[model samples]
Target chain A: MGKVFHEIRDPIHTFIRLDNDEKVVISSRQFQRLRCIHQLALTFLVYPGASHKRFEHSLGVMELAGRVFDVVTHPHHLSPEIRELFSQLDTDEKRSYWKKVLRMAALFHDVGHLPFSHAAEKELLPDEWTHEKITKHHILSDEMQEIWSNMTPPLRAADIAKLAVGPKEAPELEFDDWSTILSEIITSGAFGVDRMDYLLRDSHHIGVAYGRFDHYRLIDTLRILQAPPLDSKGEQSREPTLGVEAGGLQSAEALLLARYFMFSQVYFHPVRRIYDIHLKDFLCAMLQGGKFPTDVEGHLSFTDNEILVELRRACSDNSLSTSELAGRIIKRQHFKRLYERKPTDFQKNEQAALLIKQALEDKYGAENIRFDSPFQKGESIDFPVQLKDGSIESASSLSKTLNEIPVVKTEYVFIKRELEKEASLWLSNNKDDIIMS
Target chain B: MERNNQRTILLGMIKSLKDNKSWCGETHIQKAMYSLKTITNTPIDYDFILYKHGAFSYDLRDELTEMRADGFLSIEINPSPYGPSLAISESGQRLYDKYRENVSQYDPNIDFIATNLGAKGVTELERISTALYVCKKDNIFDIEECASRINELKRHVTIDLARSAASDAYKMLQEYEKHSC
Candidate 1:
């Protein structure tokens, strides 16, 4: 219990407390690896203040999750029925469930992330894999199991991992059977603790106002609207209404707007896109060349510093050229935003991009243009809002503002050419052909 | 003429010249200027007319040659007797059409002229015969010249509407050809 006070200062929430058992997890070399992982990945290049580490971001997430639980179960403030519902779970199961959610969400949020978040995701694994899958693999691997064994609290890490993915993949490992509830709260629905924390934390560290919101009011408003049924079938029927109902329509609307603003102002910033591309290029080059340490390949486990060191080693061995790129990035030297053009036809865009790549290669000496589609998927942000009567309504349907903003994806890419002047001249020359409308 | 109105006239003139299969010359310029005045509903400025129509500022020769080298325009940049000439390659036509549409959407009012300017500067061919002649005569025998010529010939003889290289490519060429002559 005494160990839980180990203070982790977060840009958004300030100091986050790590429990004694959790401290064992945080202090583990595996957990400490997060220190080198930038919470926003390549966003630092765009937002100078966004150099915050994943370690702190994870802690902030953990803290927010804890707050969510507290808000839902506050004895004096929450409905007695919901508080009583929480009390039904044994201490061990409750702790395990909470720990699983907090740790998994914290670590896995950026797992799907390539070296520089979405930038790398687009370049390295556009059609193959996602950062979420990568993070999911890490949590499910034998290595994660080994880390789980070392913890003093004796958590069933495998069980937690199963809960992280929900029963769709690993039904045998689920103990608490709260997979649906956890998944909905963690990944989807408006009031998920993940967004609540990241919005504030990212906003604060990245020095943007988009993340600002009434977090405390949000927390205070939380109340579990539906109860988990005694049977699987019962749980199925009641799943949709299984969330908190504070702030009603107003808070939910604000969260949606907050997400929209974050995408526009912070996540989609052009400089961040450049940083993401370069970093991913560096990592992809290393990953493909079999240069990553034997322990980290296919299964990654390293703090932010270890990643930097590995990059340095790769450069020293001439397996990578990260340093040269790093110098440019650290100085905020970025690739220019030439133009934003939508693909006339998705199919032709692919073929034409290949031709463009060949054209650039001939002119610039080697591979320079990579095809990217960042806005291919319509990201769902429908947060389930529990009604006072124990029914659930999707935030989008309940709020007029949420429904009005149709998801308009800006699908384009950031091109890093070997010859900027020549490329621009060429683009200027062939503006009609190359620029998508 | 206002730049916007001048561009539409230029595009119309280019289409007419291509239809006649004539090199960009006095007649093409005269028609383009007349179209510009008609579109603008006023007397067109001569400088705007000349600049927009590739009269003086743009070295059509240099632009055409560069496109050929880059494999974008694919036309040969050669000085013909009818002033400077342009033959849009399949690639060049595709690019020209694309630029024209882009300029139109970017600023619909001025897009006609903007598209013409972009096509002239970026999408028009330098000279197909010169490019082919250089490659064939020099025995360097680059296939690009022949490909551009084939594409240009297709544009010259066949407007089979159905068989036109994708609409996007045709539109781009339409804008480029508008300024070429």
Candidate 2:
């Protein structure tokens, strides 16, 4: 029994405890491969300290997910309405099973991320698949299958996949109520453990304060309350959801505020964004048919280590087709920010970057231009906040700060550094025409 | 779905909901879009998840926000503690007109979705839409079983509410079968 539990010291969560079964998971090759996968991808190129691996981030997520699972499912945390919905919640046996599954799901969630993580993810679709899908596949694969079955009570691969990737990404997978709520604990945009862990962990490693929040209070206050329908105020959906008490409203707002600041100041830093663009260019050129392998075996075979070796090789060898893009990463000759979306430019034309990108590509060849626009998740979270009156209100409506938090949207158009001066002059000359078009 | 097609169809639905419903908020459009795609022969693709409210699509939400940004949609912010409603902008109307033929075949479906769902409050919408979601997920049409399942899934929802919503979903299913494109 003494050997049944083990604890790993984590910077974010302090001590992340795991049982013997979970030890088998981390000891597996798939989980250990995370040691070679950097959490922020190539953000280290800009912030040298931002070199943490997915290994620790995954552990932190497991810790947070476990804590959140315990908090929201605890007897006191369970509202009478929630208990009525799932009588299974009354069972310690069932809660223990789900808690174990949630932790495992949290651990393996990002096992399928590509070497550079999400950089090439969006563009790879139609021809490829998402990291979530890959993670789902990994959880269901033979290697992990064996581990899950060896547990005291065997785990369902489907349950793990559903919780890890959530129903949104795994749209094809059917999620029952039991699975859906647990999945929300990990993937909900507002207060999911995944977002919570990444924000705190990334900020700590990247040496920024933007991602710090009162997580302890936030976690403690979480409950499976009934959320009414949002996007309108007159009616109640009375749906089960994970949220916080009124006391933690400030923490929830801070979490959203931190996300905004992090995106604006760190994740979307122009140099970091440009490095990703260059890395994507290098990857597409380096891979076969300019696509990451979709098959699990093929995807698992490549990590940042292997890709870095090839990147270095391509950097030194001028004869390689990808050498130019590779050198941009290795030698720091990445594209310069030629133009960024300004409020004035947006007021004139919403597709300002789209037009500018097209015109620039036409003038300087498509290969010389790169465009990056990251989607800003709307900050309006509808988690039901329990008020002092014992009434439930959507967080977005109850909190002034949450309602006013800005969505950090960015649109950057980059060009090969050599053409920056000429392009700048040319853009100034014809900018009005482009917006008018 | 084709880009222009999604834009035009969304415009048609937004305009329809605006005209039909007392308030055409983003949630209303999201639920309407789910029905349009799943119940009808609209050539669009969006992955629906049973979110806190009801069946929701993040891709659809993101696109709506993008449409608002790109002048295809406009928002009317309600007073504090209430969310904003959406309407198709002039540019959206122009684009809809330009691609009118693309969505013409699905007009009846869109109209049916808006008119039926528009007047319901968010709670009713949540129950009814989730009923539809259950039918879609499990391929089960038994209203009793669906209601029981919903009550079990969301205890806040009474079995009576679930049954009423399930009946609506079952009828909607029959209507779709009767009016299959």
Best by DockQ: 2
* Total backbone collisions, model 1: 30
Tell me, per candidate, how large a share of the native contacts it keeps: 0.00, 0.32
Weakest 10 consecutive residues, lDDT, candidate 2 chain A? A227-236
Candidate 2 lDDT over A1-437, as tens digits, reads 36878989888888999999999999988899899999999999988999999999999999999999888887877767677777556678877888999999999999988887887786654444788988988999888898899897899888899899997788677665667788888886578999999999999999988899999999999888766345453556656777789899899889988998998899889999999888888887778877788677888798899999999999999999888889999999999999988877876666788899999999999988999887566444456778777777666566667656666677899999999999999999999999889
Docking class of 1: incorrect
Which model scores highest in TM-score? 2
- For every prediction, compared with the true complex, DockQ reads 0.01, 0.38
TM-score each candidate: 0.56, 0.91
Number of the top-ranking candidate, with lDDT as the measure:
2
Q: lDDT at B123 for candidate 2?
A: 80
- For model 1 chain A, give the 10-residue run with minimal summed lDDT: A230-239
lDDT of 2 at A422: 96
